[model samples]
Target: MRFKDKVALVTGGKNGMGKAVAMRLLEEGAYVAVGDIDELNIERYLSDFASKKDRFIFVKLDVTNNDSIRKCVGNVIDSFGKIDILINCAGIMGPVKPTWEITENEWDQLMNIHLKGTFLCCKEVISYMIKQSYGKIVNVSSVSAKEGNPNFSAYSAAKAGIIAFTKSLAKEVATKNINVNCISPALIETRFLMEMSEEQKAVLLNKIPMGRVGKTEEVAALIAFLVSDEANFITAQCYDISGGRSVY
Candidate 1:
């Protein structure tokens, strides 16, 4: 049990990578607070972890809302007493429109969820971590941040901002023993890519050198390492989990 008694906060934990990581933590002995916008899947995901009644729970959360974050996280603290790891995995991909076709509202929507949501969640959790003098934070970034995608400007920009934020903010709190890092994955086997249109999917797949998409479990394994005692010295860096996608 690498994370025994540790409390983990996973955003967007109802499905995909977030859900995968949430389950992984629970399996590895951490009490997890699973939060997501999709109310329908909340019960389903929670059911899977029902056996671990003492270690798992669910909270309906809209990451973009600051108040929702405060309340949800506060609930976790009330139940678990402290937080050890936070994985900001709530994100969305806008339409495959050209940059010129991207609207201001689209950009703001992306920023609010991916970038701003991460900021708000972290702001609320970091204080508890500082008091405990220990914490691990992993923000889910993407390979698109490494190379700008043609129709993914909003998502790319927001993810890129996450990397920068992770580094500087990690440094700011490193002395307090709270390490913040980002995982920039290429293409992972998640719902986002699972339902992509042929054209949209083909364009993205052709760019990957691995000839296949990565699995959420693989990313979860890396996350398991980071959140464990082994990664104490690791911080202030974005660990790339891409399958040789960005050779640069």
Candidate 2:
């Protein structure tokens, strides 16, 4: 129970890696506030953890909107007393199209959710973390950010922005006992993969030296460690969970 008595706020906690992270935290005795845009799905997902009811709460969140993020954070603080950890896991894979074929709206959507959303969440939570004099934050980036995947220009660019954001924020708060870091994953096996074509999938699979896509649970385990007290010395770092695909 590394996180016993701690409070964690997780965006996009309804499904995928976000959901996995939330579950891991709860099992380790943390109070988790799950924020997502899908209320029904969040409710349904929570039902699976009937025994863990007291460990978690659900909030409807739209990460791109400052008002929504503020309200969600407020609700979490009101319920849990303080936010000790933050997992910025809310994201969407925008339409898969060639750079020139992608529309302005699609590009905006990607940036709004992946880049601006992460910034907004971090901005709102850092104040409370700084006040407490201790906190841990994990932003989810992508291998595409470092490797620059073809046909996913918007996602790659936005994820790259996250790495830069995390590094700058980590340095700014290093003396305050706040650890800021990010994970760069490649082609994880999640519902998110449903949107990809066989060709797109092949392109990504070919790059993994381990010869397999990563599992959400494996990434969640990494996150669990990063946010725990065990990682106090780790900050301003971007850990790669890309099945040996990361050159760095």
Candidate 3:
């Protein structure tokens, strides 16, 4: 039980990679607090971990709003008493369009959710972690961050921002025993695929040297290791889980 006696908070925990990470953490003995905007899938979430019900709690979260973020963190600390790890997985695939054709509203919405949301969550939790002098944070970035994917400029920029932010924060808190890192994943097989067109999917799949998209569980395993004590020496690094698409 790598996470025995630890508590973790996962945003976007209702589905996809977030759910996968939550399940993996629970298996290793952590009290998990899940935050997501999708309430419709709560029953499915509960069912998926009925056996570990005592170790999980679901909280409503709208990452774009400050008040909502504060409330969500408060609820987590109230329920679990402490949060030792944080997985910033809340995000959306904004409408696809060329940079020149993308609307101002579209750009703002994407940045607000991905970049600003990550900043807010980290800002809120860093204090608690600082007080304890120990914690691990993993931000879910995308391969698009490094590639600057065409027609998805805003998403790319936002994720790239996450990488830079993670590095900066990691340095500031390294001495406090707070390790901050991020993962840049390529297209993984998940419900997120529903947001992409077939052509878009094909274009991405063609770039993976592995000849297939990655799996959520595979990415979750990497995340599990990053947040566990096994990775205590790691900080400020962006690990590529891009199926050989990234070499640097």
Candidate 4:
């Protein structure tokens, strides 16, 4: 149980990679609070972890709202007494269209969720982590952040901001025993991929030298390592899990 006694809070934990990470941490023995706005799927998420209900909780969270984030963090602390790890996995695949064709509202919504949301969650929890002198934070960026996908201008920009934010925050908390990092993954097998058109999926898939997309479990394993004691010395780094799609 590498994560025994650790308390982790995973935003967007209702589905996809967030759900996978939550399950991995729970299996490793952590009190996990899942934060997400998708109440409709809570029952299914609960069922997936029926055997581990004692260590799992579902929190209603709207990442774009500061109040919701504050309340969610407070609820986790109240229930677990402390939060040792934070996975900022909440995100949306914003408008996939030409830059000029994207509406202002579309751009703002994407930035608010991917960038501002990460900032808010970190802001709400860092103080508690500082008090304990222990913490691990992992923000989920995308390969688009590094490669600048053709039709994903806003998403690319927001994810790039997440990487920069992760680096800056890592440095800020370097002395407090808190490790901050991010992961940039190319098209993983998530609902997000299903949302794409066939041509879009094919275009992305063809970029991978490994000839396949990444798996949620694979992403979870990387996150588990980054948050565990094994990665205590690692911080401010963006690890790419792109199936050879990105080598830098």
The model with the greatest lDDT is 4
TM-score of 2: 0.98
Clashing residue pair totals per candidate (backbone < 3 A): 0, 0, 0, 0
Tens digits of lDDT, candidate 4, 1-248? 99999999999999999999999999999999999999995677689889998898999999999999989998998998999999999999989999999999999999999999999999999999999999999999999999999999999999999999999999999999999999999999999988999999999999999999999999999999999999999999999999998888
The superposed Cα distance between candidate 2 and the true structure at residue 32, in angstroms, equals 0.4
**Root-mean-square deviation of candidate 1:** 1.2
lDDT of 1 by residue, 201-241 (tens): 78888877788888999999988888888998999888888
lDDT of 2: 0.94
What is candidate 3's lDDT per residue for 45-120, written digit by digit as tens? 6898899989999999999999999999999999889989999999999978888998999999999999999999
Alpha carbon deviation, residue 173, candidate 3 (Å): 0.1
Q: Alpha-carbon error at 72 in model 4, in Å?
A: 0.6
How close to the true structure is residue 139 of candidate 3, measured as C-alpha lDDT? Answer: 96
Reference-based lDDT, each prediction:
0.88, 0.94, 0.94, 0.96
Best by TM-score: 4
Q: Comparing 3 and 4 by TM-score, which wins?
A: 4
Compare candidates 1 and 3 on TM-score and give the better one: 3
Locate the minimum summed-lDDT window of 10 residues in model 3.
Answer: 41-50
Ranking by lDDT: 4, 2, 3, 1
> Candidate 4 lDDT (Cα, whole model)?
0.96
